[model samples]
Target: MSSGGFHVHGPHDHAVEHAAQGHGHGDDHAASHGSEGGGSSMSKIAMFTAIVATVGAIFAYMGGATQANAGLLKNDAAIKKTEASNQWNYFQSKSTKQSLAELARDLAPEDRKAAYQAKVDRYESEKNEIKVAAEKLEADSHKFDRQSEEQMHQHHRWAQATTALQVAIALAAIALLTKKKWLEYGMYGVAGIGIAVGALATLHI
Candidate 1:
């Protein structure tokens, strides 16, 4: 018991203090362990996010490059087509000149008929030459068109791969926020899918 300046403690009070001290130590130990685990999880998520972003950037760049190449090839096809049209026009002009020479031969006097016939023969040869050139130009135009189509197809694949990677990154952000074990597993699975798609792109599938 406590009088004027003296204080007294009962057995029950002492027991209560001991129990509180024990609980305090146990809580501190658990908290410290939990903080270490959370730090590790954060580091893992951050590193994964960075890697996925870098991969996505590379995919985006490849997609743009393929698209540009396709456009250039298509332009080449158009230019070739124009050149072929010009050649066909030239061939037509030669045919007209040949027809005129043939008509003159038919109506000319016997003495002058030979000269007109010679002109007709020369015009026929010129027409044949023009026809060959026009055909060659058309073939070149077709080749360019085929090449352009292939490039466009490749660009589409790259775009698809890039999209998958972006989705994976979004999932990673969600997992990081939630800190759920299932979410972490989901994040990994999505990341794997994204990488597989990227491989398909590289293979030109």
Candidate 2:
């Protein structure tokens, strides 16, 4: 029952959102100084931050979505497992009936023997059917569990990508404030790393 809204649920998601918003206007103060080259640099960094922020937002949304999917799928797994248990219980009951019928067949008088043997045969057939159903349910449960685990892994990748993007945004903000060329380089490097991580997430690596 996951919906379309991308609410910031994680602490890291909040941080990325805040960083994204703050950096969009970060160059304003730097621009007021009116150094032409510096102004251009500040503007470019601001734009970079904006783009990274957009990517981070996407990553955050994906993280939330995958997390929700993981939970839902895990619930499905649990439900299936419970159903499998019930089937097993049913199988056990049928087994008990079969045992009782077998005993009756052995102990019954000659005239009644055919009736008890027929009951025993019917119970055995019913037990086989229940066993097949129980095994199928157990297999289904395992499949759901595996799918849930994969979704959780994807969620972690998205979170990591978002975090990296947030760091890049932070660097852009600092570089904008200080007008340091090395910090700008650092910002670019971190931004590249963030995008690379996002690619990994996209590939589900």
Candidate 3:
């Protein structure tokens, strides 16, 4: 009787131990699955952030290029304006000489009047040529001014786009740190605005 009881008790103890080990294994597997899920989520976030960063860099470069172009145009406009002013001054000087020639012709003695009249005619013709040249320079100056203004407007658009992209990058970083879905959506929205502005800049709108 004692030998039979020991055999039965041994089998019962083995069964309980096996059950406990199985339970522990199940818990470990569940924990491992949880960790894998979390890691996958983090990997996805990192990939999205990398994509946004690349786009942001492109936007920044475009903005810089636009600003450089605007500066160049502004300088050109200023130079043209200076040239126009110089031409106008020259026009004024020619007008003064023409007036002086006319006055001299009116007051000269009758014998010398013909020579002074010839001087007056030459001065008038030169003055008309100078006026036409001065007007052309002023028109050129105005054309440059319009082009510079257009470029400046484009620069402003590019700058706005760059700013929006920067904000989106910051938001993406925040979303990664916090693991918030809503923040990620917000980041996308800002990035969309940036892309739209960049497109508009390219169109010169």
Clashing pairs in 1: none
List, residue by residue over 79-192, the lDDT tens digit for candidate 3.
Answer: 777877887788788778878878887898898889988887887788788778877877877787787778778878888888887888788789878988898899889989
* Candidate 1 ranges beyond 4 A from true positions: 1-26
**Scored by CA lDDT, what does every candidate get?**
0.88, 0.89, 0.81
Q: What is the TM-score of each candidate against the true structure?
A: 0.82, 0.82, 0.80
Q: Residue 13 of candidate 1: its Cα lDDT?
A: 85
Ranking by lDDT: 2, 1, 3
Cα lDDT of model 2 by residue, 70-122, tens digit: 99999999999999999999999988988898888899999999999999889
Off by over 4 Å in 2: 1-34
Local accuracy of candidate 1 as per-residue lDDT tens digits, 1-205: 7889888889998999999999999999999999999999989988988998998899889989989999999999999899999999999998898899999999999999999999999988988898898899899999999988988888888888788778778877888888887877777787787778778768877
lDDT score, candidate 1, position 135: 93
Ranking by TM-score: 1, 2, 3
Regions of candidate 3 where Cα sits further than 4 Å from its true position: 1-37
